[model samples]
Target: MPALNIDFSDEELAELRETAKARGVTLKSLVREAVTEDLAQRRALAAMTAVLRAFTAEHTTAFDDAFPDDAPTGARRRGAA
Candidate 1:
């Protein structure tokens, strides 16, 4: 596999090294895990946004009509008055 080089300030590098040592992991492993998790979170958010947009496009009018101006205010459980 290819390798990548990153530059960090002395303070930042020291902090990362300290955190990795405290976790009993190498700095590379710690950084790799963080990057992986961030990418996954971003992908999940994008997917959720797409689904919401599609649902809104398909149901905007129906959703609006279901809650007309005189809709009741308080909360109610299923099959409740």
Candidate 2:
């Protein structure tokens, strides 16, 4: 596994230390878990974006027709149709 180096402010470091202590884990373990969770979250977001892009690309024409061309010119609710 690769090692990561990160920098935090004094107050942030103090908070991390307190949080780790409260969780009964070492500072290093807490940092590792945070980094792992962040990376997983980023990957999940990337996957979702890719899927949305692919879906739109595949259905551009039909998706466009799903709405009416005479939509309220600006952002206004015309009337209760």
Candidate 3:
């Protein structure tokens, strides 16, 4: 695998080293895991946003003022139980 070169302040390096030691992994592995998880989260969010946008466009009238309760779906609206 290709090596990655990164620069960090002494303080930041110390923090990273401590975190890696706490997690029982090398700095390289910790960074790799963090980067992978971050990318996966970003991709999942992007896909969910795309789907919501498509749903909104396809059901414009149905959703208009239908969710007056701005809360999540499980919550009841103002006049509904």
Candidate 4:
């Protein structure tokens, strides 16, 4: 129930208004939907990043063993350096 005030260039406002009208939504509704979708995408990205980090931490040695040539010079299994 809080109000947010955002300023847009005249051209940007015109484009947003036109797009909202074409989609049969009020400008406020259009902006709200866009914000919701953006937040969802950001949350998904954060989760994906965490999963990837965990995978790398757990599998780095396995990967290095599987492809020994990919390992750093004389350094394999995470501490052969």
Candidate 5:
């Protein structure tokens, strides 16, 4: 693992340091844990979005058939239909 230099505002640095001390963890570990959780969350969200898009694409025809006026193809217009 490579170390990276990150600059933080004085107030933010103080808060992070205080939290690390209270939790009995190094600031580096705290930051690393946050980054790891955020990356996992992003990956999970991406996967969920892909599944939703695939499901929508697979059933778009059924949706369009059920609701022609409110179809995703912008059939709805102001004061029309």
Candidate 6:
């Protein structure tokens, strides 16, 4: 595996080290986990956005009909169930 070097201010590095120590993890491990989670979240959000765009384009009429502009309030629609 290759190594990557990152630069951080003294205060920032100190904070990261303190947090990592508290969590019983190395700074590298903590940073790696955070980066991995952030990337995964970004990928999932992009996929969801693409799917929503496609669905909206394909089912515009049906979607509109089901939730019309002047539909009754949710409470009224649910009734006394």
Query: Which 10 consecutive residues of model 5 have the lowest summed lDDT?
Result: 72-81
- 4 against 6, candidate with superior TM-score: 4
Q: Candidate 6, residues 1-81: lDDT per residue as tens digits?
A: 988899999999999999999999999999999999999999999999999978866765565578887444555443322
In terms of lDDT, the best-performing candidate is: 4
Give candidates' CA RMSD values in order: 8.8, 7.5, 8.3, 2.6, 5.2, 9.0
How do all models score by TM-score? 0.76, 0.73, 0.75, 0.87, 0.80, 0.74
Tell me how candidate 2 scores on lDDT.
Answer: 0.80
Q: Against the true structure, whose TM-score is highest? A: 4
| TM-score sort, best first | 4, 5, 1, 3, 6, 2
**Residues 1-81 of candidate 2: C-alpha lDDT, one tens digit per residue:** 887789999999999999999999999999989988999999999999999978866765464456657344433323323
lDDT of 3 by residue, 28-76 (tens): 9998999899999999999999999788667654554675455334423
Candidate order by lDDT, highest to lowest? Answer: 4, 5, 6, 1, 2, 3
In model 6, residue pairs whose N, Cα or C atoms come closer than 3 Å (at least 3 residues apart or on different chains), thus clashing, are none
Tell me the TM-score of model 3: 0.75
Between the candidate structures 1 and 4, which one is better when assessed by TM-score? 4
Candidate 2 regions with alpha-carbon error over 4 angstroms: 1-5, 70-81
What global local distance difference test value does model 1 have? 0.80
Would you list the C-alpha lDDT of every candidate in the order shown? 0.80, 0.80, 0.79, 0.89, 0.84, 0.83
Cα lDDT of model 1 by residue, 1-81, tens digit: 988899999999999999999999999999999989999999999999999978866765566568655443444211135
Q: What's the true lDDT of residue 48 in model 6?
A: 100
Model 5 lDDT, residue 71, Cα: 70
Winner on TM-score (3 vs 4): 4
